[model samples]
Target: MAASSTATIGSYELTSRAIYEPPAAAVREGSRILDETRRLGSRYGEDYSDGGVESVAAQNASAELAESWKYPRQNVFRTGAAFWSLLTSGANDAAYGALIPYLEEYYNLSYIIVSLVFLSPFVGYILAAVLNNTLHRRIGQRGIGITCGICHILAYIIIAVHPPYPVLVLAYCLAGFGNGISDAAWNAWIGNLDRANETLGFLHAFYGVGGVISPLIATNMIAKADLPWYTFYYVMIGLATIELVSCTWAFWPNGPEVYRQTMDASNEDNQGMKEALFKLPFARVTWLCAAFLLCYVGVEVSVCGWIVQFMIRVRKAENYPAGMTSMGFWLGLAVGRAVLGFVTPLLGVKVAVSVKILARLLEGSLAAFGGSGAAILPFAVGAIAQAKGVKTLQPIILAFLTALLGLWLCLPRIGRKQD
Candidate 1:
């Protein structure tokens, strides 16, 4: 298993390294998701909080027990809608990142203030994490989806109008909150679906699709289009409006609020969340997963978020063409996820003989899809930035270097022989 394979993109060897381990029992036993969750649930399932498998099993059943949710059309619609929702969010994620430099100019603010636009979304994710269980049980996932759609709508409207800086920040924060709830609920719902892994893959793939398209559109608007710079947000408003209708159609279920997984009382669910949070082993694993993701997202967001500025500053590339650099990175990500997903199972994890590669790429294509593509390609472009100039590529190089370091630190065992 030569984990390192160099595919050429022009002169450079796009040498991605990977160590491919087969799936474990949990993933291997695909159809047994609920049964397996039940078995795990019977023991310490209640300790697995945040609307995941660790519940009291309201009727000795999982969230999959809701009969009203079993409509074939509805299932397909829900999954499709979720995919679109992710796509829309993905677009916003990258668009805003690309927009950062523009935002700084428009708001006449320092980096910290402009950066708040990104931080505000976390406010939504945190609130969603805290209230996901209670809210879903109360308002139904459909309601949350609709709310998320509206939040996006309102947020885009505010941005399009070019309100005062404080107002812009508040609007972004609101959108982030919606984004958080929608993301949590839809993922949880999809996790309970048939062919859950593949469905989840699709959901994220669309996210990459959004990521790829966002910069292409946003760059043209701000850097090239004769339309107002705010025109990009006007397009977003249209998309968000369509998303609202789609969510309502997919999730509303003929106006019935039928999303409670069971008839269990509310207090019991709270106790389940508490127990999950308090348990040492579960809490430890949970936090580790969180830390890994924090690093992963930090890389993804940082690279996608900053690449446009990188190109402008370092390469002195034209704004319109520079946008393509970010677009290419996300395109690689989306393609990596889709292509490698179909191929990883074909080969076992192997080693590559060459210069040291990034640890995550050596982990495999599935690994690359997560956020590796987001950081790798654009940053690689940054590496060459100095060659054209006298060493202007430092920012891009340093940024990706930090990403690789984060992956290495988080997963020290990657690409290493197990003793």
Candidate 2:
């Protein structure tokens, strides 16, 4: 069969690259092609034959499959770039930890208004589930990403200029929308890429690194400078500008059809966007992700956000300065994640979880009983003792509990491949 006598399947245009050969060569090449096609079909079930194809169909299918293979690589590249960009942008801090303090000090925001700022992102996330596909179709992933990048930069600038609280709130809402949309699109794009599990882990690790670094950067600047709260916003603005430029350059000449294909297949269960996002097997996974995120952020923020104050006020650990203590928490988190990445695959996620749980228990017990000197332990722990010098243990105990919760939450699917 000629390569041109091919058919389209999903986004792929199939063609046969088989050459005329002797009997033995033909048999070898035929078997190889069959194996390759099977593998391709398994990976992208939407793009290939449900049943065995005839000679003509097989030729067409082979060409389409070949075309389809190119996308996974492109997706992996784009996803990795997006992940890195997201971290360097500094938007995550504004949405997560710094928002409360910024609002309180700069804007004198009321409690209700502050709560709204914090909650708005989740609403944006949910809304993204509805809007993601449409936006992808209308503007393409690259375009949406570029647009999101611009929005993030604008939001940072708005906050840096010290807009009115209402305007700031609107700016954050816009930032939330950008974050939600970009997150959904990039997640879906990366999920479809080759070696997706490893890529996902790497992407998230970068996110973790960003989370760890942002607070340190903000706190360090504040400690050194005599400027108002706006200095941090300036830093964020600078970071967001870099992200915008990177995204724009990376995704030039954007259009929907250039990257991913539209999914036109019909489904009984996925009758509407909400049903598709919130229904069935995915609903549980989504809820689990949300719960894990909540716990992870809470523990992470508590330690990094409060540890310095806790150290200065409660522990009175003069040896370790405030900046160093916060750095320690982030360093611990980075070390933990790095260790987990190496150890999880070797020992398996279940074993890793068990090990972390046991380690935390031991650490917590020691901190609770061993007193102030327990701060010397490799892991941070938080414990409150009745004695004068024992309060230092509280942070240590908190760190242990935080690690335990994270391990427990991640245990179920630690080693399992995603569907």
Candidate 3:
């Protein structure tokens, strides 16, 4: 009886040990499954078809493994997933930002609260940047994305119910954190593509789609029907759900394996990524890229956030009209992204990504800087009219308007005629 009890305890310990590390037989089986891939990767690299029998055998073995693993056509799936995810992201932004004022009014929002809401997301970005690779390495891209989706689900639901000011602040923080994680993950996933710039352009074009359409839905309901602004969160809930499901479905079962394979193939010759980055001109170029994106986003988001008020107060427009003005700006963004996507491949991905980023910085900076000047310029124009004892500023307004109109109407025609 004592010997039987001893055997039972021994069996229980073996089972627990297998749960953590598996038996050596199972480990060997896993290793053998990837042995051909390692051999191929180590010997002839990712593309080793030099008409050699050994390489041919390795290739066939790797192909069979890929087929059994359910990731036969790797390149096609991820790009499509990224495009849809970005579209959802863009939609969420429009729905939420369009009703900021109503949100403020309902929550009795203070400037400090607003500052916290904006700041919390950056904190999340920092967290994701630090932790993303490690977590992705452990749990796969889909795992990271699933957590991001859960954050969104919690965040929007909290906002939809019009939670207390402190709770709302917490919700926005959650929203920002979720956004940061997904954004980093998507960028990492898509950045590795051969046609990175072209795919990125298409991805952002969907962002423009959301930016344009989401606002229309929000404004029509809020400005026209006077529906409670919190109602917009339902639209976001729907969008976030779609994003979550699409990403989950696309990356399931084999995403981590594929990532490992891709990373191994890509990194074979470059020493290490860190070593290469610290080497000369590449480091400098990386810093410049980072700086440009920082300034570009600051200017872009600021303009998008405030332009509605500018139109409403300065142009004396009603809420619906002011909202439409924002939609027009977003529509232009969408159109530009779609058109520029074609241009990306022609320029080469590296040059194209840099130049496009610079162009956006230039475009957004000029608009913001010029808009600020325009805001002050009109008052100065009015002051001159007042000083001259002109009863009406209409003549001055008309003269400026006529010159602007002439510029708008004639420049394109002259350019076409020159062509």
Candidate 4:
């Protein structure tokens, strides 16, 4: 009886031990299954709501990884589309600079009258800025591509037909809206990618490339081939057509539903532009950037737009050589963007900017100085030019440089220590 009880107890003890401790192979298999479960959960997890212990399993899944050119194979095509859009914009913009002289002659107008083309575009640009977010939310990037393409094609067709002065001005407004949309959308898209600085630098370089090539083609068509000014736009129509096709195809998958899903996964898109502009520290940065770019673009456009005329009128240069000067300017800009993209990261942004500022100051103290005064200078310089002739270009440019210095002094204080 004692032996029987002992044996039964031993059997019970063994059974209990087997139940408490799983076999090594079973343990390994179970761990493997758990790991896969976690992987899947993370991969498809909902927005990681912090629900204490329950959220631990999904903590790694909620991260928003930066997109790259490789991961989404389609990004390569999208980027190419973006580059081409900017290229079109560059060509369009540079053409105005090269054709300004021809436009004045064709319309039998003074500088003030011909300058209306430049002013009219601002109306389109302002509207584009206001409507950009709404368009993105409603139709997504696909719509943007289609809409901008239509705008460009329609505008170029109108310009090619050599419409009346008022009609021509209207056409440029349409073109400006298209350029603004592409500019804003593509910049935002590429900026969110990995190595944004280098990418954006290269992107702008394409703009410069367009700038470089446009004047060369426009000048030759007019001076060498003896083609009409309107004929230049025929080339633009073809390029815009390509832009429409590439952009539409590349972003076809990025519809409103896809955009909404992506936005829902990230909280960053929740803030409105008004909120973003008014949000303390960020506001200061935003306003500063806006002001600086306004100045920089003003300087760039003013120089590029007027340089051909200046070369012809002020410098007494022939048609072909005057146009080539603008080509040289754009070439320098393109080279800088391509080369400095690699160099800037190593030098650091702040240091690079400082170096650029220093170099700019040395080369031409007032070369890029600009402000609201500069913006209004078309009217101002027009009046002065009437009284003083084209020689007023020098004085007006000098005045802008002075205004720029004053504007710099009056800029919103950022990062400077208060007394």
TM-scores, in order shown?
0.67, 0.59, 0.64, 0.74
TM-score top scorer: 4
Candidate no. 3 TM-score: 0.64
**Clashes in each model (backbone N, CA, C under 3 Å)?**
9, 16, 0, 0
TM-score, candidate number 4: 0.74
- Candidate lDDT scores, in order, read 0.61, 0.50, 0.58, 0.72
Instruction: Assess candidate 4 and give its lDDT.
Output: 0.72
**Clashing residue pairs for model 4:** none
* TM-score-superior candidate, 1 or 4: 4
Candidate 2 regions off by >4 Å? 1-80, 89-91, 94-117, 258-262, 265-286, 298-327, 334-419
Candidate 4 residues lying further than 4 Å off, grouped into runs, are: 1-65, 270-275, 347-387, 398-419
Model 2 reaches what TM-score against the true structure?
Answer: 0.59
The C-alpha RMSD of each candidate to the native structure, in angstroms, is: 18.5, 13.3, 17.0, 10.5
Error of 1 at 233 (Å): 0.7
Clashing pairs in 1: 3-351, 17-362, 18-362, 19-349, 19-362, 20-349, 45-54, 47-276, 124-177
- What's the distance in Å from true for residue 11, model 1? 88
- The deviation in Å at residue 271 for candidate 1 is 6.8
Candidate 4 lDDT, 1-419, residue by residue in tens? 99999999999999997886667776666666555444333343222122113354355434234365544689999999989998998888778779989998999988877777766667667667667667877888998899889999999999999999999999998998888778777776775565666887888899889999999999999999999999999999999999999999998888877766766764445463444367775455445545555555656666777788888999999999999999998899888987876776575444434333222111111111212212344544555566777677776677666766766775544332321
Q: How far off is residue 125 in model 2, in Å?
A: 3.1
Query: Residue-wise lDDT of candidate 1 within 216-323, one digit each (tens)?
Result: 888887777645667799888887887888988888862324554342522344454344345664344333444455556656776677667667876798778777
lDDT of 2 at 7: 37
- The segments of candidate 1 whose C-alpha lies over 4 angstroms from its true place after superposition are 1-71, 254-257, 263-276, 339-419
